[model samples]
Every structure is written in C-alpha cells, then in structure tokens.
Target: MTRKRINVGLIGLGTVGGGVARLLLEQQRRLSDYLGAELTLARAADRDPALAQGLDLPAGVLVADGAAVVADPQVDIVVELIGGLEPARAFVLAAIAGGKHVATANKALLAHHGREIFLAARQKGVGVAFEASVGGGIPLIRSLREGLAANDISHCLGILNGTCNFILSKMTAEGAAYADVLAQAQQEGYAEADPTFDVAGTDTAHKLAIIAALVTGRQPELNDISTEGITKIAPLDIQLAGEFGFKVKLLAVLRKVGQAVELRVHPTLVPLGHPMASVDGPFNALFVEGDWVGEVLLYGRGAGRRPTASAVVGDVLDLARDVLCGCPGRVPPLGSAAEPEGPLALAPLDQTVCKYYFRFAAQDKPGVLAAISAVLAEHRISIEAVIQKGREEAGPVPIVMLTHEANEAAVQRALARINALPFIAEDTMFIRVAG
Candidate 1:
C-alpha cells in the first residue's frame, strides 16, 4: 500500500540538524502538496532534548534516544544528521535494518565507511541520499549522477572549504597575516575554535574522496591523497602570487590520468583570469570538465545552517518519493554505479607533473640566487620567472620564482637541496601551479 502520509524521523538537533527540522516544519504544506502526501515530522532525537524546544515540534514529539525514532513503525524516512562514525553509523544501520530510507550529511562517515553503508542500503533495497555530504546544497552529486551523466568526466577541482576561502580572501584583501585572518574568521564564526580540519585540508580531502567516487565509481583511500593545509601560507607569498596575476586558493584536484585517477588537495596558484581565482570569501566553486559537455562550474555558499538544511531536506524528499512508490534505489547512493567499482588506482604523487611556485628566505647576499639555480637545474627543474626583494643592508630577503613543468619528485628533491644551503631558511615553501 502507498503511504498517504510520510512520517520523517530526524536524529541530531544541532546546527544543521536544527536547520533541517525547521525547513521540514516551515515548508510542510508545500512539501506535502508537492509529494501529494501529508509529510509530517513524526519524531526527533538529540543528546540534549531541550534544543528541540525552539522549533515548536508537534507536542511530545521530541525524544532523547535515536533508537526510538528508528523503532517507530510510522517513520518512512530516517534522516541522520548526527555526525561521527560510531553511534551515527549504528543508528543509520539500525534504520536500514528497519527498512526505512536514510538521508545524511556526514561526509567523514561516508568517506571512511561508505562502502559498508552503501552496501547495506543496496542489500536492503533502500536509498541512502547524501547530496548534503559534499558542497552543501550545491546539488553537485545530482548534477554528476543525472544531469551530466551522459559525458565522461575528465577532471574536477573545487574550492570546497568556506572557512579557508574566507580566511584567504581576508588575507588577500586586508594584506594581513594568515594567523590574524584565522582569528578574525573564528571571531566571525567562519572558523571553529580549533580550525585544524578546515585549514589543514582534511575537510576538503574528505569531500574529494566522495567526488572521486562519483567520477571513477570508487572511493580513493584517504591515504592515497596528498593533503597540505593553508596554515603555512604567509602574506608575502600571497602578495607575490598576486603580483604575477595569480590567486592562492585551497583547491581539491581530481583528474583522470590514463586509467588511474590523481587525487590531491593543497593551496594552488590559480591564474587570476580563472573562475576559481575570483571565488572568494566563504563561497565554494567546483569546475568540472566533461568530454562532450565541455567545462561546467558550480558556485555557491557551500556550508551553513540553511544551505546544509536545504540539501538534507532535498535528499529526504527524494527518499520519500522512493518510499511512496515502494521502489528504492531509484538512484545509487554514490550517484554512479550501484556498488563501489574500481580499485580506482590513484596515480602516485611522485609521478605527477605540474608547474610550481617557490619562495626562499635567504641572506641578502651574492651567490644565493646562483646556488638555488644550480640545485634546481641539477634536478631538471627550470625556472620560468623570478622576483627578488632585497635591501642594501644585507639581512634576510625574499627570493620568489615560478617554475616550468617539472616532476613532483624532482621539485621536492630540489627544494630539499636548496633549503639545506647555509644561506637559505629551512622554511622555504613551494606551491603547485594549477593549469
């Protein structure tokens, strides 16, 4: 029998969880009218039950245990907003066992244990919708799975972290230090008190794993990705990059090389004319290249209460449709193949080739440039441009340059050798140039 009224059980009443609850309630009539079923919030769970008070949920509808929501026979869809691996994992699995469709935004849980979760849903013949898991509310997953499904996706790169973008944009516009801008972001609630994940690139890497899965039909091991954070970037480097018509953005790159996929994340020097360069201040953008469709870029707010809530609710509606029709897996969870497909061989970073930007803090004295040049030349790395800022007083100065296409291994070796020189600071840094 078709469900005349869909009951939604929500777990987790935190930031995004709260947003989901609000959207579901506020948009109840529209949702019900659209689905042709009276959609209702049957129950909700959170560690702190008091948090649900402000939402004006139906009387006595709030619960303290997620298991209660899962056990409710009336619920046709269970939305898992409680993040993390253990209890969230357990809750989702229990819901699936109960034959309820699941919707989630837990990217880390999905990236780490997606195979198990996806397989479980496939076995149960239920849909696990996660459009909110990456690029919040951007509809990126749907676009990859449905809209652009016809073409072969050759490359995908995104500025997926809003905190990093906000900080970097402030640093670029204000000419302030990274630390100062990070503090400002924290003050403004753009960054967390401990902003390690966002700044360190782990957050973006997690999103990349999901994206690469959609692209290659398999998830790349997190270990296979080369992740470098924005904590080390200095104002001087940003200024130098701008001088050369480039902007620095923490970019997540996944492109096909032969049969293997190359997945990596780091701060990149994007040319000023590129769309990625102009994407600034807490906005996220993804640039995808398909064989037939050419290039497509998606730009959006990426993260926040309402934006994330919008995505989760969208997934909920999709699952609700499947439930009403008694036909699940209308779309695979990963949006590509039904199961995780490839060992999706990830190309070794050492074999990667790209242009690079180098900055060295060296004594303002003769022979420093020649010494650096000799080491780079030895490693077959050629410099394309140079900019040196030094004073007659002969203290430490900055020597910055851009290199032509060179092997990743060669650049690292050359940098290690160059930094080891007596006149050079061991803190010398290098950034990859995006094509």
Candidate 2:
C-alpha cells in the first residue's frame, strides 16, 4: 500500500531544530506506522544557511528563507523552532495568514503572545500545536487539555525548570552555596553562560503562565505573578530545612482561590514526604489537582536534545495524520479558544497563607529570645517549633523556628523589627513551607 506524504516546512535549524529533523529521518517508518501517514521534510529555514550544508537531506529539500518555506505551495505544515518574539512572531503569524498549520517549542513567544497567535490561527482555520513548549516530553499540556478535560483543574505545582532544579539538588545534597553550584552547573552544560532567566525564576514563571492559561481558559497577567529567585538561598538554610524534614526547591505554583487564580514561582520548602521533594537533578515533575483526579503527578526528563525532539516529533506525527485525512483544520489551535472573561486576580504573598521556616542569628545575651518572641506575638504569628543551636564562633547564636500557617506580610514586618534589634544579626533566612 502506498502511504500519503505530508510535507513539513521547518524554521530555525539549531540544536533542538536539528534534532527534530534527525529524529524525523531516523524514525520515519515508526512515525509513519503510528500516524498512518508518511512524513517528509520538504523545506527548512535557517538564519545561517551554512549551518545546514553538512546535514544529510532528502532530495529536493534544502534551506530557504522563513517566508519561502511558509509560502511554499508544496509545504503542508510549518514547524517553528526559532526562540524569540519579533521575527518568530511575525513568521508564525505569516504562516497562519498563509493558511499553514503551525507547531512551535518557543515558550517565551507562546507565553507572551499565545492569545493573539491562537486567535489568528483559529480565524484562518489552521491548527497550532505546542506540546514541547511546557515540559519537554512530559506531555503535560495535552494531559490537561485532553486527558483530564472532564475535570476542572484547581491547581498545578511543579519543579518546572531543569537548570534551577539541578542547582538546587546539588546545593541540598552537597551543602554548596548558590554561586558554587551554579558554577558547577555551567561547567557541566546544565546551565547557560548567562543563566539569569533560569536562576532568577523568570523562565519557570513563563511556563507557569502558559499552564495556568490552558487550565483556566484565560491569559494571566505576567506582572501579577509573584517571583522569587534561589540566589538568596544559603547553605545553612538548606541544612536547617533538611533537619526539619523538608527539601528546598524552586517551585512554580498556580491555584484557584474562589473565582481568582494565584500564580507564583519561588524557593519553597516541600515536606520530605511530598512527591516533589524526591524529584532531584535535572528532572521535572508536576502535581495537578483536578476535581475528579484528586492529585496526579507527572515526572520525566524535562530538557535535552532527544527529549525535546521526541515531543516535537509527536506533534509532527499528529499533524501528519490530520493532513492525510483531509481534515487539517479539524482541531482548534488551543483545542478550545473561548476566552473566559474577567481579570485574573492574584492573591498577595502575605495573604496567601502557608507554614514558614525562619532562621535567626542573634546575640547570646539573655533577653534576646524574649525580644524576638515579643515581636512575633505583636504580629500575631505563632511558632510551632523552636530549635536553638549553641553560640557559634561568629557574632551570634543560631536560632531556628517553624511557624504555623501565617500571613507572609506580618512575618515580613516582624522580621523587619527583629532586624533592627541590637542583638539580631543583619542576615536571616526565611523559606515558605509547602505540603
């Protein structure tokens, strides 16, 4: 039996992009069998044409400008691997405008302008797939959009960033400081030359925003999502968190509180017993809570050339099946694009109640403890446990306290007052406790 061939126009033949091409060639038979259609890479676009010169290519397939690939009558679908806003956005919009089905792995581009792009694709009656945008090969977006579609998603919490997770895992296991672990991560190629986006929590926040929008049917305001980096985490704090039966991880959390949704990414202390606590190294894990499923955890390799390429190929195969059936526009861009009304209200950090771990360095003087307790009382914060380590070789003794669920604003105010005291040291560490 002769199989139908679906031509693919690829953009950005970089690391992941090149991998996608290679995977399509290497697994052509398998993918064809799964999709019940043969897939062919008909055209590709690369900023540097020289980069594509050495690759193995099927006859009649070659590098061309992005527009050439998108506008080609022979091209059936456009796969976007370009990783930015301006040209990528323009190229994607142009592809849809030209009536080409699109697939992308650009998270930043999607996070910021998904609504606009999805709307444009819907109007043109073309499908837009982004399975690789969120968690590499995790298939999290599909699980929420299709598998668990029956239930209303209440919340999603996860260790979404691989670089951040690797750094934190090293710090927790070896008791290394942030700079030292980050340096090691860079040397090992787990982190980028400039890892500000990953370390500063912006990267995870972007992923969180995409997931939140998919689950809630609305685009969340980026500025409203609270963000805190792991740069401030100290080795001593990691030790204390472990002693208290918790692991410190940079977590992206999105939950519904009444009609509002709270989205935040920060360094949180997860209970040792929790599923997320065991997710170490460069792995990613997401715990989703749905009305029917209760809680489900998805864990796997978050990022790598092969893992990400696997996801890209999955989308390509799905699109191939649609093309073969003569129903290319059957599925909507985002599965469903009815924009839900109302601004997504974010709960302030303080009002978002959670247990906390506070570490204080104070003078060995007598009444120091009393003063600290008094300040906490003034703010109506109650302590659940206290561990006071003896005087150190340095200026003050280390005093650690675990508090019951309390408003973060009051805790911050109390910490400010304690910082002003003559006995307390300038440095203190506070981490939120998550269960």
Per-residue lDDT of candidate 2, residues 1-435 (tens digit): 987778899998888888898888777788778777777788988878776755687776766678888889888889999898978999899989988888899889988888888888778878888888888989988887788878888878889999999999999999999999999999999999999999999989889888887787777777788998899998888998888889999999987878667788999999999999999999999999999989899999888888998998888777777777777767665555465564456777667778889889888888888889999999999998888888658677889999998887898899999888888877668888874
Cα-based RMSD of candidate 2: 1.7
Which portions of model 2 show Cα errors greater than 4 Å? 329-333
lDDT of 1 by residue, 1-435 (tens): 564998999999999999999999999999988988888999999989778878999887799999999999998899999888889999999999988899999999888888788888889888999999888979998888888988899889899999999999999998999989999999999999999999999999999998988877787787789899999999989999999889999999987888777899999999999989999999998999999999999989899999999999988888888877878888887666555554557899988899999989898777989999999999999999999986656567889999999999998888888878899855688899997
Candidate 1, superposed: residue stretches over 4 Å from native = 1-3, 338-342, 392-394
Number of the top candidate by TM-score?
1
